[model samples]
Target: MKRPDTRAASVGVIDIGSNSVRLVVYQAMERSLVTVFNEKALCGLGREVQTTGLLAADAVDKALTALKRFRALCKVQKVGEVHAIATAACRDASNGPDFIAKAEKICGASIQILTGPEEARYSALGVISGIHKPDGIVGDLGGGSLELIDVRGHQVRSGVTLPLGSLALQDLAEKSLKKAQRIASEALTDLPQLLAGENRTFYAVGGTWRALARIHIIQSGYPLGVMHGYAIPAAEALAFVRRLRRLVAADMLADIEAIAEARRPLLAYAALVLEHVIRIARPTTVVFSTFGVREGLLYSKLPDTERAKDGLLCAAQDLNELLSRSAQHARELIDWTDRLFRVVHIRETEEERRLRHAACLLSDIGWRMHPDHRGEQTYGIVLNGNFGSISHEGRIFVALSVFFRYEGLRDETAPPPLTQQLSQAAIDRARVLGTAFRVAHLISAARPGVLPATHFRTQDRKLMLIFEHQMVDLVADRVGGRFKQLARLVGRSGSIVRS
Candidate 1:
């Protein structure tokens, strides 16, 4: 196994799935995978694989064409290495080996045909890479097969592959929904542990599942459009799946503008499969994971030390380094805020602390945007950013905090839908964190210099900001006013002193 080139300018991965062939170019960062370019061609390689046991001729042609273009794309993007992996369709198809040979020639890279368990393990690793402390069963439903693996933290348990994928089941059951459901349930019956992941999370992978999640997000008017950590209660998810199962093609196309027209055909089968899984597994939540086999391949190449880093923090740091005025200042902000929060006696749980750290690292990402649009831009960026390891609520908290930091406390432009999902306590804490950031920025101006030495202390039931005598010139009415606002939110009167 070749170690990932940490200094590689870019790395490309082509995922040849049952239904689609995608080429993703990622700027391989120190601790994060940032997508630079991604395009998918729906080749439907598994369209007739269940019955014919061979890759469709037209599908193979399309995939080959796509591969040629993707190879060119890698060259144009200056990608140092390109990894190509073919999943269920290629593994199950009789002509798969021939296709792989031709694909290797076209793409100028060897195509690795992943076995069922290998696919399951990679999908699980994808979940582990994107989620913090994931302890549940990961289900990756592709067009040809479904891969289920139990994952706890970074460890992967034995997984099973079922012939119950949407496309395969559609053909297996002759497009009968009831028969598909029965087949899925029966296929999963032997895996009692997988079916009995009660109250745990069921992480959904694969393009079909992501499309279903997108439909749900649009139908429900979800504020955040990102799907990496989109989670819904098991009951609501099951209900939504059931509703999707009953929806006609016209209705589905009309209701979900997020789903592409080509994907609409598989919606019902996807829903039917999901509904059966939900009924048996009874997970407390259904989480949509954007990471899958492709991401897992990248993750697997990383050194163990790099892989052990926190996913959310890695993303935050990457963003800071890429976009902020000074990544060092962001690190300083984290440390400075740590002292501020401790001095203010702000109680933060471990999760809250991690979110706060991420927010601090991301605080200055919007500096280059126009002043008027910075707040809105930051809000959208943080909310929809490719961050992993944080829940939807954590995303909301971080986005809102950064939004307030740039937009000020009195701005009425906050999106209500997102804010409403957060608790009052969470909202207040975010406000405090944001206000702290605002004050910090005012004093430091997002520069790489040392911040004015200051200490926060409680005196006579009031918040006192004591500045060093040498740093008194850095304090101003604007800085004091922001501090006072944070003080108010924390239910304390505020005063500033140069000592």
Candidate 2:
């Protein structure tokens, strides 16, 4: 007997952009797609397109070579399907069609050349797929063009694209920072998409913006280094980018190697574009997104039902299925906690409820680890997991709850530094949920069909855990003490009842 070849189920995307040629192979085409392989080559296909009006011969050769390598890598991975798309440089350069024709033959795949509007729409969809209930403008700056669109929730309004990408801007201004500023300002003047973005989020999507955000993260000493959903106040962001404009590329790279070497010189051009957009758009916050055209394209192909699923919960459910003692036990825990919260009058917002559900699914993931290290390990896993639709603050809350479940909610059981990102109210709530986990896990022993037989009730200012007759023997001193701790967190006494 032989094992099945599961690698054949993977899907891949090859993105031909102005500045970079990249390939990403995802685990599946489902709602919660995971990247199994990712690689990129900085080809600079649009480096001379702005001035020469043609793709540079060397740049074209570099892109085609990268594509050939990507195709072979996809074959080695046994990728079931591969979709190739080209943007900006390919569509604008006069020789772009000829280049695409050659590249297609080399990769053995038909390439879709996306127009500016199509690029804008896909970028907006990518933002919508990653951010929960996003209401903002999505601006994708590539090496040759910038796409701007307005999005609220799932709806994407009309969008506009401009020739303000870093490489293109540099070529247009002949490497003059002052001229780049003037060109960006002139190109973005009085755009309605930007006008509609006042006081809302400006979702920055592109490699350059991600590199810029990485710099911000390294400098701020932020606990979580995840780039997706990193946010900054518009005023503060303006000040930072303005400071960059005054410095040379060497100064910008001083003591900072977090950004790519190829991307360093373009930083000022990117900053200039951002500065002008912020000034005109008057957005309140700038959010950086790792998801962009590729993610958006995948999202566009999904059915509405799949698109409606909660990404965080979906990802968590996958983890629970893979690692839990019993996936059914996790589901029962969700319901049991639901009853407990209601009985104890623990109010939760809709978002908080979802976070709690995800935490329950992930609570037992560290059971396979050593007892001494389970808390720390699980905390780090959830804190840095490749999850979306949850903010950094929400991540801290969920992680802390699971941490308390293993480590025990005692004063001496100090939490990690990331907990500081959450509010005091949220921390208290996590402690309460974690204490509930402590009691529940003990009663059921990580098995299903035990929690449903038990329920919670309140009388005379005392929270009571009532167990059926068959489960009476499972109760003990430790259970009572843990229940008491949970009750105390909510300002109530604790008791256990057998019925």
Candidate 3:
């Protein structure tokens, strides 16, 4: 079967959950999920379901209005197809079918009301798609329920759904924190055995968990504000949750910019569930996942071959092609650097090799920026860019390398927390890569040809740059200086020879 052309298409997805309804339009590319447009309305359909066992008339009206608006937006954006999915609230409410019929008419798309188990499976798939080789239990806490599943890499094992969602628990516990904890504890009694293992990581999904993670990121002064791959030691996460559990509404809202005004009311309930899960699972760490049901649905549409492509490489290549001065020049840079690293007896771990490849592809992305600001601009882009299958450490390595490449060696712009996470060896490696890129860019001028004619070698503890005899005049003083700088970084004197 021919694989789907996900890269060439734009699609819209509508996620109707208990607490909110969201419409996201994505420009799906080979290795990246890029959100072009997104909007959400908090309709609290789940709260309505918990209260009266039926979708509320007011909530239905609000949701229908949102659906119509979403349909118009998708039309204006020229989205080829739209996928509308509803979870817990719509699936469990007595009047759900009636609402779905109306929603379909307004949105002009079939609304998929996922069963509990189906929802669990999709949530697990989302984790697999976003994380690299994820092996642990994934807990997706939505407004109406929580779904827990064991995932070994990309495979999803059996999962269970419980009525322990923040909004639902808030209603069940009658707004008491103690009651909410007790209810959460009771709901999770059977999950501990399911998660029993050594050094397992728990992947937390859903908006509420993301909100909690955002707060932690701000409070801890983490350099990377992105939450998709944020991780915390289990012990620390437990303590944080415990503190959140004891906080009153006023305290939850105090001086915390991470928590939005609308999400404040759900923090305590989110905390209760997180605390119990951490205590029961005893995971070595808790990792946050920004992709959940919506991402899962998109992943499900991909062909297996596309699904198997390295996400980091795909995203890197996409950005490189879009921003680089010459894509061929970037490829030449990769090959040129590979040969140099081999000649210098430098070794890279598999992960390091992948990061190096990505860095090379992205080396010239800042050429369009003002010359004075290129290095700093490139550093920020790599630091905050949407490249998946890369960890926090890897992000720092790539960003710092690019920063040094553009900005030269400077400590003035380095953030203490970011530097603290890197080892001396990692820092040294980044410097070497950065210096190497600086030399390559000068020699090729980020153009496409003659890279293969130049060679690098090490002899008598001196780094030698061998240029073809015909290209001798092409090597400028600035290029020679960068080459010597790279040589110095590797503890060697620099020499230039014409072969």
Candidate 4:
């Protein structure tokens, strides 16, 4: 989906939580939504606001700056309508109205402070619409508050909001687990009755909760990255919480990196709360989801009639809307490479084709430290991407192919093995297939229709290159001699000629 146009209608959701504020831009056409922009800032506005009863000066400043930037981005992105929501911070603050007024002045968008119950409802609605329609309890544990709603038999019913978010509890009590447990036990006193229904599942939402889930997965070497419907058995989830509870926040994590940074300190608090809630709710299972209130806000406001459209639920439609999940374009790149394979005499079976497509979808995903390190980053992202729905061979193919992209580019003086996880022959094919992707980039030179031209037949031990002459030189230079070697390996050709 393209960015929202100034002439067309758009919706922006600004979520003001205790720890973060986010501005999400969605393009709404005929009641269907395609999120075009997503930007978030960590404010921790209620970091110590709960105890002081005043928003911290720095947190307020950070929030104002983020809102101002969000406002400008909305205007630049052509967003037309905006719905800004403030959760525990504003709701709990006596000066929240003043904060909202100031934020509105800075952002040029009205800010609505949500009541605790209202927050729970919106969060529960978000989970139901964005994820499963199961009978369970939706637990959205935030930095400053805990919102738990009961979903029994497809009906979203009663829930309670407690002043027990990680930061909020830390401020109110001490940073220790004993202090956090006290807050959680008080907050979860209502859970037993709420989860009294038959065979309920526990759905954990919020940044800290999801981070814990990822940590568990990463630490245990779980095979997948798509966490939308990922599950952890009640026993494992509870046990993980126990381990976290035993350690201090400082002791639990040496250093949080990547997406897990901000949530590291909050993990112990989140875990303490989760253990109490689970004990009371007595949930048989736990499902962790990356989507939350932002997703719910988008779903809730859609014209009711269009909410039932099912075609958009297909693979690309959902994944395309997310930056990380933007696989359609990458998939198309794979398709183009498939056509190039025939022209270049690269022989791959149906299985190879499938795995290559998976690799392509993940080629650009990296460790997020640096774009220049994309190849090095792709190595890690591929393993993290999971592609679990595919076969074991498919997973190995993606991991190996992605590693091929960065192995040589990495700054390591001594190079590592060609295929990090595959055999020598598999590693060789990945080199050839990865070359096709690099060639496509060069041929396109970042332009459309720059993709490889039709029919690349080998002649006289040379790859008779066959793109529009305009791109031939570009492909040759950009590919940096990989094309010749690839052609030779594929069909014993040395030189490549352009058509």
Which candidate number has the best TM-score? 2
Better of 2 and 3 by lDDT: 2
Candidate 4: regions farther than 4 A off = 1-8, 29-34, 152-154, 190-194, 259-261, 311-499
| TM of each candidate vs. truth | 0.93, 0.97, 0.93, 0.62
lDDT of 3: 0.84
List ranges where model 3 is wrong by over 4 Å.
1-7, 192-194, 249-257, 410-417, 469-472
TM-score ranking from best candidate downward: 2, 1, 3, 4
Q: List the residue pairs that clash in candidate 4.
A: 343-456, 465-497
Where does candidate 2 have its weakest 10-residue lDDT segment? 248-257
Local distance difference test, candidate 4: 0.67
**Per-residue lDDT tens digits of candidate 3, residues 47-71?**
7577678977888899999988999
Order the candidates by lDDT, highest first. Answer: 2, 1, 3, 4
Model 2 lDDT per residue over 265-290, tens place? 89999999999999999999999988
TM-score quality measure for candidate 4? 0.62
lDDT of 1: 0.86
Q: Tens digit of lDDT per residue, candidate 1, span 1-499?
A: 9988666578889999998999998887445788889999989898888888999999999999999899988988898788889998899999999999999999888888999989999999889999988999899999899998999999999898888777888878887777787887778765765765788999999888999898888888887788898999999999998888778433646545667776777888888888888888889999999988888888888899999999899999988988999999899888888988887788989899999999999999999999998888898899888768899899999988998888887756655347998999999888888888998888888886555377778977798888888778988898888888888987899988888
Ten contiguous residues minimizing lDDT sum, candidate 4: 310-319
Could you tell me how far off, in angstroms, the CA of residue 364 lies in candidate 3 after the best superposition?
Answer: 0.7
Model 2 TM-score?
A: 0.97
Please list the C-alpha lDDT of all candidates, in the order they appear: 0.86, 0.91, 0.84, 0.67
